[model samples]
Target: MANKKSTKTPAKAKKSDKKPGLIARGKAYMASVRSEMKRVVWPTKNELVNYTVAVCASLIVVGVSIAVLDLVISEGLVLFASLRG
Candidate 1:
């Protein structure tokens, strides 16, 4: 069998072989992305509302917990600093 001669150089061969024009490929990619996005299972209005309220309540609880911890730590640091002075 005869050996096949490569027409492409090493650098050019390393790049993508299936390179299409930018605009055409971008439009095709966007069309595929839109179709895939349509397949997503979005939450209903009631479920969305419930999730929003749950997140807000958790945020408030965490905020208060952090504030209380900050106050306790600040007081302890101040007391220790005063004793050292």
Candidate 2:
């Protein structure tokens, strides 16, 4: 008697190749964000205030310098144009 191979069909296995839907992706992204946030070492109150003041002072200095340069250049241009005319 010859041994024969079984011809029965195998059961279908579930496939996980599909991409996650929008809500699932959003939840995963938020979870990752929250996890990263937990690892942050935030600045203290004094450090925050010092940084704020430094930024404001730098801005004021830059603004004043730009304004003075603009005024000087404009006046010089007016004088040169008037002398030429």
Clashing pairs in 1: none
Model 1, TM vs. native: 0.73
State the lDDT of candidate 1 residue by residue for 29-82, as single tens digits. Answer: 999999999999999999999999999999999999999999999989989889
lDDT on C-alpha atoms for all candidate structures: 0.93, 0.95
Worst 10 residues of 2 by lDDT: 9-18
RMSD of 1: 5.6
| Candidate 1 lDDT trough over 10 residues, lowest sum | 9-18
lDDT of 2 by residue, 8-59 (tens): 9898777877899999999999999999999999999999999999999999
What's model 2's lDDT at 4?
91
Report the Cα lDDT for candidate 1: 0.93
lDDT of 2: 0.95
